[model samples]
Target chain A: MKRVKKWAAAITVFITGFIFLIPFYIMFYLSLSSPGDSIAEEWFPRALMVQNFREAWEKASMGRAMVNSLVITVGAVLLLVFCAACGGYGAARVKNKINRMIFYIMVLSMMVPGIINTVPLYIMMRRINGINTYWGMIMLLACQSLPFSVFLYESFIRTMNSSLEEAAIMDGCTRFEAFWRIVFPLLKPITATVVIMQGVGIWNNYAQSVFFLQNQNYHTIPLAISTFFRPMELIIICLPPGRQLVLRLLQWFF
Target chain B: MMAPAAVLFLVFFVLPLCQGVGISMTDWNGFSEEKNFVGFANFIRFFSDKRALHAIQVTVVFGLVSPFLLNVSGLFLALLVDSKRKSRVLLRMIIYLPSIISPLIMGYLWTLILSPRTGVLDQILQRFNPSLSFDWMGVPDKALWLIIMVNVWQFTGGPMMVYLAGLQSIPKDLYESAKIDGAGRMQAFKNITWPLLYPSAKINIFNNIIGSMAVFDIIMAITMGGPGYATESLSIYIYRQSFNGFAGYATAIALIMFLIIAVPIGITMRWMKNKEIEM
Candidate 1:
């Protein structure tokens, strides 16, 4: 009876895993087949034509959109990492009423639903001519995601040994130099986590991209793909690159 | 050091939130040279507006249903994968594969799968039931369910990981003692597993409820809250209102959503904190 139950459990798990994977397989199969050549219902195409990827890339102007996405993501991640690290270090090291208040406020206010800020932010972007600008969108996104990043950085930094930095300072290294030379390098693991999290957050972001990037030229990958209904484009962008990025990100948490 | 982070937070989040409150008091078109304040008019209009009320109704349902279902499934999957088996890691990764894709893309893919005519599902079903057709994206409730299903699908992975970790952290000695006490599997689980899993459950449930309540990208990509606002979540409603040149009304709706979401989350968190303290 026990053996039978274990087999049933294994089969159930296998079936669930298979079901979860079917959509990805279907997406991949669709991407490989030439458009208008066959029915999408087929489990597999008889002929595997790969030319659709290049055509889809050009037709959607995916290159420009990709470049725009890369710029925003890299810019936002860098700014977020640096600023969050600094703020986190201060919050961790400094013991003052004001600092404690700021830390608590940030952690609590992180629960504010993001959509509530959209209308006013839209207006602010327009008033400041931030619409369609990379820095404008990047800055807004960085700030939107800042509270959690600061929380994570502060908690992570607090657990690490601070004696090394104190020793460095005692040896006459300036504060900035001590942090840059001795302390920051130890933050590599948390830094990677931040990068993966923020990287995926920026790459897969559509709401802000749609709201701010009214011009087609400024569209991010997810935004561009959603606005334009091209299967090949969807697969090319969402399949390989997206899957790898997410897998890497999920690894950190696991 | 904190100046940059604080300045960004102030300029983007704090200031916009305050300004949103001010804007909600007016009847300003989203963009115009002239503006006049009409205090509480938009809020009053929200109470009487049928579409806004319908959106609230739908959002509440979506928020409640999706989070509940996601957590249940997440915990189930976590248990299934927690067995001491060789393929567990691969199985876990495969189950989580769908979550990594943007919900926008997932919604788009689901629309194709759920399409009535040329959709993969319908096409497969046609062979067995030639007269059968499913128009999930067109119907009101079905579209809502579809949106909810997609949300659950994309979000279950994170919670599953959380629960798996929670399960692992549970000391084996408790379970061993329960087994030695001649407890059945069900009895052992009831006594040992469920109570110990509360912390993970608390975190997962709270996150899921908040995240699913603000669901926008999936709804927008799939049906655009269309077929007469059938699947119009509050976030979508806000998006539409703002774009249709009713920034004040949109802000009013957003504020309502914020209060509804925030108050419950805050209360539940406090209650949970107390529960943790008691235990």
Candidate 2:
């Protein structure tokens, strides 16, 4: 019975790992398979080809998309970090009702779904002629990402000792100087958490980019990849037999 | 210092939420100048709309299944990697790579793999066993399940990292004590590990649940709630209503979804706070 339980646990772990990996395996295979491989019934690619990556890269305007994604993601992350750092410092040190209210408000802001305001946000963007502009997208992404950033930072701040701030002040540091010089530096671990979490969140975002950025030239990686699906489907509709077999084999192996 | 954050939050977050509510009560077509107060009509329409209701059902199913599976699987992975391991950092990185990719890209990538014909997945299944044939995303019933599978794949990494942090915080002495008491691995896990990991479990479940409830990109990219609305969630329904020209009604649906999620979330927070105290 004990041996059986151990086997069950081991098998569960293995299956979980397999589940995590299967899509990646599929993606590798799909990326390697040629466009004309039309055989619908096989799993492994018979031929290994790098053409799909090249094709996907060029057709998706990957370079420009990467730049756009990077600009938006990095800009948003920096803005969030700066704003949250300041806000977190103020909320941590100030005991006023207003600061408490501000903290709760930030928490509440997180629950508001992005799609709820997307329509008005688009209209607002258009009015400002900010549509498809990197700044506009960055501002929107920053606003959406700020609540969690502030929350994480505020929690970390609450756990910190206040003596550092007192010492900095005794050494003639102003409140702002104390926060910037002492508090901000102390937030490295939490900052790492915030950066990783928000960076990944903003970088991987697609819905906001899709709605706000209509210019084809301003497309992000996600938008570019999405455009590949239909065209690939269209190409698969036209392949001949023997080459199709090669395509199927390519699909399976990669 | 709080002024800037407060102003931004009020303008971008608070006001928009109010506007979202106000928008739901009006008969404003997205681009039109003319508008009228529709009151409860939009809400009435949403509740009665068959397609919208189906989407809500699908969204609820996805929310329930995906969070549970992802959290459990993540905990399992965290436990495996946490126990008696070297190269754990490399293993963690490998597992987390997918979480960094945009869900939209992942969805697009998966659509290719799960394609009915010429998909790598279909080809591989055929190679191993001739009778094992399936169009993973082509069928409506299967499409919803496929979306759930994709979500689990993408999000398990985040929770896994959190769980790893939690596992590392557990003292080595507890396990040693369990072993001295004749406890085997399972016994040690149940007696020592499980009780101590409750806090991590709560946080992981809370984060994933809230996150999963707002799932939009993956569904949009992969199936577009398609093979006929099989994978539609509340967020997708709102997108369809908003962009697809059901403006006020879309806001109404959004409001409903907000309520559905918000009330339960508020309750969960309260419950978890109390549970934390108890622990």
Candidate 3:
């Protein structure tokens, strides 16, 4: 009976993993095959070609998009981590009623959707002449992501003991120095988790990029892939029947 | 130090939410020079609109079904791979890979695979059964299901990891004790594992529901609520109303969605808090 259960569990894992991998397998096969070859009955590519990838890279401006995405993600993560670390430390250490009030207000921010502010944020960006700018996009993402960062940091900081701070104080360090020297170092794991979570999220984001940065120069990878479906003269000349159908479906949806 | 973070949240989140509620009560077109308070007329319009109602229903269905299916499947997957198997790490990586792919890219990639004319699925189906041509995105019946399937594929990995963490935390001694007491595998799971996993279940359910409700980019890329309003969700509907020149109506729908999400979330959080205390 135990053996039977183990076999069943193994089979379940295999089946679930296969289902999860199907789309990725299809993507890999399609990316390798020529546009015409992808429509063939063969699941594996008959004639492997790198031309599609090369063309996609150039036409989509993926190289530039990668850099733009990286910059935005890193910038937002830095700002979020720095601010959240300081704020969370303050909230944990400071005993004032004002600090408690501030902490609750930050927690409330997590409930509201960022989309609610889109129109006003757009207008503000325009007034500041920041539309289509990288800084504008970074700042917007930072604002949206700050709430979760502060929440995570605060929870982690509360778990930490205050003896480290006391030791630093006995060593003649100032309060700010004590926090910077004692608390921040211990918070690295939480910061790493925050960076990974928000980094991946910001990197894949499309809405803010599409709405804020209209210029081709500032297009992130998601937005660049979107532009591939736009009116491009090369598409008519190069795309096969199957690829054209895919493009049409995307255009209809978008 | 907390001052800057607090101010940013208030300015961006609290003020905007308050302003949105105000806008929902008014007959504002988002860009008009004149605005007037309509006093719950927008809410009334939201309830009366058939399309909006359909979108709401779709959103609720997706919210419930996708998370339930994903969490169940994820928990099962985690349990399966929890044993000391050589392929466990490989299986885990393969399962989690989809979470890393951008939804827009995934949407585009799936379109290539699901296209009726040249899609791989069509070709495979044709080989086994020649008369199996079906319009996946074009037909209203299959479009929403397809979207749900895509979401499940993308998100199961995250919940699987959470469940894996919970599973690891359960002491092996408990399982050994259950076995010594003549408890079968199923009985042991029922007696020992299930109770211990409740916290993880609560968290996974809450996260998946909230995350799924906010789903926008994938649907925008895949279906756009096509073949009529079959796949229309609240978020998509809100986008249509606001950016698609129905600002007054859109604000109303947004408020309705906010309520729908908030009330259920609040209730669940409260219930989970109680459960946490009991545990």
Candidate 4:
């Protein structure tokens, strides 16, 4: 009975793994197949065509698009980290009624639909010359990410003891300086979580970017890819170069 | 000092939110220079419009159903891959890889696979059984389920990870003790894992409810709310109405959606938080 059970477990794992991999297999197979390679007839990459990658890159202006996306993502992540880290510290240490209220408001806003902010935000962006600018996109994304980022940072900081920063304050450091010099370096773990979570969303942002960034020159990757209905371009972007996805995910697990 | 952060949040989020509330009260044509206030009229119009009501129904239905499916499947998959075997790592990654693709792209991917006559899926089905053919994606009911299925597919990674964390945090000693006591597998799972897993379930349920309710990009790419507005969600309706010269009315719909999302999430969260403490 135990042997049969072990066999059952192994088979279930194997079959489910294969079933789960089929969509991705289709992605690889379709993206690499030539025009003549029929998807219905063939289940694998028959043509092994690398030419589509070149075509997608050149035709889509992906180099420029990637740079645009990178700038927006990196910029937003930086601004969000700075603001959220400080805001989190302020929320944690201050323990004031107004601070708690602001923190709760931030948390609640996460449930508010992006649609609610779309029309007026566009009008506001237009007024401030923010409509097609990189800084403008960065500011908007960082703001969208701030609430959750601050919430994470605040919770992470609560688990920490504040004696180190308190000692810095006693040694003639201002509150801000104490936070900067003593406490900021210790926020690596939560900061990484913030970067991974918010960075992915910012890189893949579409709803607001569709409105605020209509100009082609300033287009990010998702915006650029949306113009063409090719899965080849998308799968290409989803796979980061030189890293297996298993490697990428295992870090989060182990 | 979160001064810069506060300034950005105020300028970007709070200001626009206030402006959005203001816009919902007016009869401003999207591009018109002149605007007139029409308080509560748009809100009243939403109730009278049948399309709006159907959208509300569609949104609420999708919101409620998809979350249940996602959490169940997520926890199940989490349990399946929660072994000590090395291949477990690979299985987990395969399940999660699709989620790395944006939902908009996933919609397009599914569309390319399932488009009516020319799609790969149709072609494959035709080859397998020449007489078997149907338009499931084109039908209203099937399309809603299809979108929910796709939503679950693309997003189950998040909940899976959460549940896996929860499962791991559960020490193996309890299971060993239960085994020694001759507890059946089902009984052990029911009495131990299920109760201990509530926190993860709570998080997954809460996130999925709001996320599925506010779903937009996938449905936009999939059906574009077609077949006579059968699948048009509240979010999609807000977008369409906004651009089609009913900016104020659109904002009103969006605010309604906010209430729809906020009130339930708030109540459920409180209820779950209390239950979690009790557990």
How do the residues B1-279 of candidate 4 rate in per-residue lDDT, one tens digit apiece?
A: 656767888899999999989999999867888889999999999999999999999999999899989998899999988977788878888888767666776776676567666556787888899776656688988898888888888788889989999999888899999999999999999989988998998888888888889888788767878768999999889888988988888888989999898877887888877666333
lDDT of 2 by residue, A1-254 (tens): 99998888667656756766776665555555555543344466667666655544565577787788778888988888888888887787886999989888888767767876876666667778778998888778888888888888888899999998999899999988988888898899989988888888787777788788778888876666566444555655653222222222222222
**In candidate 1, what are the lDDT values of residues B80-173, reduced to their tens digit?**
9997777888889888876766787787777666766656677677766889877887787688888888788877988999999999998898
What tens digits encode model 3's per-residue C-alpha lDDT throughout B149-178? 888888798999999999998889988988
Query: How do the residues A1-254 of candidate 3 rate in per-residue lDDT, one tens digit apiece?
Result: 99998798778777877887776666666666665574446778788765655565666666787788778888878877887888888888885898888888777656655555665565456668778887778777877888788888888989889998999899999988988888899899999998988877888887677778789999877787678754523553567433433322222222
TM-score per candidate, chains pooled? 0.92, 0.89, 0.91, 0.92
**Collision pairs in model 1:** none
Name the docking class for model 2. Answer: acceptable
Residues A1-254, candidate 4: write the lDDT tens digits.
Answer: 99999999889889977866765555566667666665778777575766656666766677787889889999999999999999999889988887787788888888886777888888888889999999999999999989989999999989899999999899999999998877889999999999988888888788878888989999887777666543533443454211122211211222
lDDT of 1 by residue, A11-80 (tens): 9988988878887776666556544433434567566655556655665677787789889989999999
Q: DockQ of candidates 1 onward, in order?
A: 0.47, 0.40, 0.44, 0.41
The per-model lDDT (C-alpha) reads 0.80, 0.75, 0.75, 0.81
Off by over 4 Å in 1: A34-41, A230-254, B277-279
Model 4 chain A poorest ten-residue lDDT run: A242-251
Off by over 4 Å in 4: A230-254, B180-182, B277-279
What interface Cα RMSD is found for model 4? 4.5
Question: Which consecutive 10 residues in model 1 chain B have the weakest lDDT in total?
Answer: B270-279
